[model samples]
Target: MELKEITDHPSYPDAYWAAGDEVFQLMDPLDAKRTLRLRANLNHNLLLHRRLFLADTSILVSPSMFALLHDEELGPGYRQLFRDGSIVTAMRSAANNFSEVAALIIEKRNFVAEMEEDQIWASARLLDSLSPEIVRTDTRDEMLKIGHDYVLRAEYWAALGIPENVALAMTESVRRKREERNLDTVRQSEFWEYARDDLLTPGEAGTAQQIRAYMSIASLGTMAKGIGIPPIYPAAYGPNVDRIYGTHTPWEHRADRRMKLLEPFDQKDPRRLDEERNIHEIAALLTADQVSKIRDKVEHRKLLKGAQQAIQESGNSAAEILERALEEFRGYLEVGAGEFLVDWEGGGRRSLLWETKTGQLMRQFSSGAVGTAAMIPGVGPALGTALTLFGWRRAAKLEKWREGFREVTQEAINDPTIIPELRTDEVIELSLFGEIPYSFMALGGDAEEQD
Candidate 1:
């Protein structure tokens, strides 16, 4: 562990992604060698990388002053000396490593996005396992614990005392974790089940957290629509209107563009409302990562049927199978929205909402969404549309409004509600965020009521 005595691993050259003219040194009085040596670098983005170290790397950033070749999100990519030239990237190995680390960081901070959270964490863990000896001293547990949020508070949690920027990066990683969690609660029902023992982060978060997460996502379609666009006006019967005209706010435009990605769905942007839409988007991607494979055409329905059959044939409590299957199937279900009724750990019964990928995959099969989609060609899109956020859009009046409302409804599903069962009508009304305004949705429900 001592600097001089601990020679570089034979696999790599002694020279590494260092930042400055001289090697950076850390005095560790506690250690017998009492010294730590690392490559240091300076970043020109003075405002962002003010600490003369890697604070936060954007996906597009590069490393300078001899830094790791990680992407902007990780810190830096690679650096080259061109006198006054500022470095934009780092070494290939560093870049790859940083990218993995970046994913790990995102996994935890953005808790609502379960899918990507799973994928990124899996990827990060894969990288760590594959390249264990590369950076033997590097702290990878944090990355490993990313998807399972709340691990920062775990008793084993330890900080490696890296550079200030790296330290802060790690710190913010945790801050963002809890912040996003709280953000989830802020948007939905309060009593949502916390992830169970076999299924939670170190944070001790409960069911309310999940409900909030579901609602947060289900609402995204509308939030996306409303976020960066201006208000819109229906193409009225005034002049021969070629295109529908709506005065979109900056947020509205953003939401509008995103919604255009999917047809026949309402787009509501959460940006202007400052509802943390970016987090929502990222969470959606992470959610994709978590259960995307289950959502994939291959397993969605097959597994669901298997689980149902298993429950029926075994004559066992369907609770075990159904409860666990909720995770994957929840997204596939157009059942409006779901809540964490109970937890599997912390002395509570397992949640029927199934938070695991296996469970989710089972739900998809049992729920009839995938099999039906496979059985009939055209029915896939229609089935998906109905089961997704648009569970109530058909009943609405206007064509644009109905489709748009559908978009809004879907986004809200990801974010769970704090209160117990809510009427679908109320949730739909809430989904009309951008199109109809909160006042309309707010009118039906009691603001003070908390279940």
Candidate 2:
């Protein structure tokens, strides 16, 4: 298809596709194939994922930006960034420290240590859900290494807008979308937050244009790394390192430190890599609101399983289950995250009527998750006692309680006036150990049963 004819999604534009088209159209097929080869042995420091590499390779040229920062393979192509005013201005603006955070990002130092404390912690928090700490020290070193590499490469991409000519050729829609998307940039870190604001602010001289240029470069870099290519390392490994060990001389100390930090991660391990990929996949499926609302993995998993079972038991079709469950939890679901710990603690045939009359008891019942509780016998004292006595008792009798809880919950869900305190649109951070520390594990009568 012609470049202008390509408009895959709002995020991906015609100009970007056109650029890829041009690169492929002009290149010699054999040479292109050779350039795209994964030289892991030669580029050991780079991050390479086969799928991302293959996908990006099919779209554009590799080894161009890859070799730009590789000291050993420094070529004339690397100088092209300097010639581009848009890239230079954007990089200068983004790299506020000039010699600190910016330097570390593009250097091999990223694999060794974090560039900023705030950003690292933020990243760690974001990653905690995916790669949970099995042990006290299960810091997910490998995952963090890859994340740092990705962030650093994002910087380089922002600088060059890989395929400079194509970025320069962006359509109006693509350019406008880029500006809008830039606002979603995580503002947790001050540097990035300010950089985004400065670039986007009105009256800033070519800041937005420069950012768009960088975004174009960043997109190409993402495609490269998405498939399997590793992030690029700058040729000049900081002036401090050079001062300690002359410019021509090797920094064995720095190399040793980098090796020490990276020792925890083994990129060669396919299982670990797959696990990491799965983490991303899971994160994608869950919203930030949902992830944040989860109290703990144990509880979340239990609730999730219970929801699936509840949906299945409800006799609803697979297609209708999601809609039904969503309807059931509508107002009860936490804002932004769309999570609602189903509250059936006070569930019983009469509980809903009682809650409707005595708001205090209803408030108490509203606490705790609904998933598993929905199945529990939230019946009257006699039936609850009977179920406790007869362990094999079917949950069919609890349908009344389920209905009662649903009735009351539906009111609150539909009208926030019922429980104004619980209804809010705030978004909070996901819990590392969100499990409620306190729970009603038993319902009394245990002594009689033991006796």
Candidate 3:
């Protein structure tokens, strides 16, 4: 490739090129030649390196905009948060509850209009005396209002990982490209081809690939490429233009460090093999229908292994496991006492029930309640909700509580108040439930045996 092909882009950073020379010098010439160039915006470079097996000589660049924005303290550094798997999570949430979002948009428009009228009336006496300046003043006020609205919207988008400046730039870039190519009327496949082959530079192409791999969305599907929706949506989906305009923040670097801290507990941890083997055997013995219900529950492999180990060591009978799972499933039906709390009960659940999901209860829990969490079996909404509780506890640094909750829940299954309905592999159901019990909290528990 020509030097210009690598260095000509506005997104290309000077430090990246400077760093490249040092990295390249350390590489064997043949390996350097074979190295593939992969550029990502912000801290996504770390993700590319860790996930894609990128060579040291491979050119990795961040947008120059990120470098410029660093002075503002809201630049690429903040952008790294997007790569922390939070943005994608937020967007998925928004997409899942689009109807509620649409309703909110309508409500906000009306609220804004009402506020503007009140403000205008409050300033009417001052406006009446200066008629000539009123026009200019009113126009300026309107522009300021517009700017403020845009900023708020931009912040909302940024929280979903799309920075405002990057979003705007992507909009302009897509508009320019579509007009230049006259791709407005192009078919989906043809537009996708153009987007992949012509619209993006090499760095952008690499970024787009990363976004696709990361998002798991390879194409726009039946969605056409056009100048509609400010063009940025297509560009973001196609060439990853948003990432091309930002950089990573210090916060993102810290997040990466935290992620690294969790690496030692990964699948290869020697202490987890026995538990994993038990889980595997249990999984093989589970009913196919039961397996499908808990598919989304166990995201953390290490955590799941630990939960399995807890259950295996408990020496509980298969009938006891079934009873515990059934009781937990029943708990989910008790609306007010369900497994999910307000903030924890996310997704579409928030819209369905409000009385049981009071903000006060969640606030108390978040403020430091030694809340209960459990590992129980059975299909239905309860399993996912239980897992969500466990996730919140883990995120909140309630490691002891989490382990205790798990142990307590496991023991709770043996309560005579509830009847065991289903008989499946105890380990499989317990694995799906995925929580460690707090045995010490129960009456006959050993205080010294802590997780």
Backbone clash count, each prediction separately: 121, 25, 13
lDDT accuracy of residue 246 in candidate 3: 17
Decoy 1 TM-score against native:
0.18
lDDT of 2 by residue, 298-346 (tens): 4434433434443233322321332333333322222322222223232
lDDT of each: 0.23, 0.23, 0.23
Q: What is the lDDT of candidate 2?
A: 0.23
TM-score of 2: 0.18
lDDT digits (tens) for residues 1-451 of candidate 1: 1111112321100111112211111111222111011111111111111011111121112112112222232222222211111211121222245345555446434222222444544433433332222221221222233213322322212211122342244334545644756532221111112222222443322222222222222222122122211111111100000001110111111222222212342234212211212111112212212222223443345434544332242112322243234333333332211222122122123222223252231121111110000001111222112211111111233467545644553443322221111111110111111111011111112221111
Q: What is the C-alpha RMSD of each candidate to the true structure, in Å?
A: 23.8, 27.5, 27.4
**TM-score for each model:** 0.18, 0.18, 0.20
Candidate 3: worst 10 consecutive residues by lDDT?
222-231
* Better-scoring candidate (TM-score), 1 or 3: 3
How far off is residue 67 in model 2, in Å?
38
Model 2 residue runs over 4 Å out of place are: 1-166, 169-319, 329-451
Model 3 Cα lDDT, one tens digit per residue, 40-96: 121222211111111111111111221222324333332333222211111111212
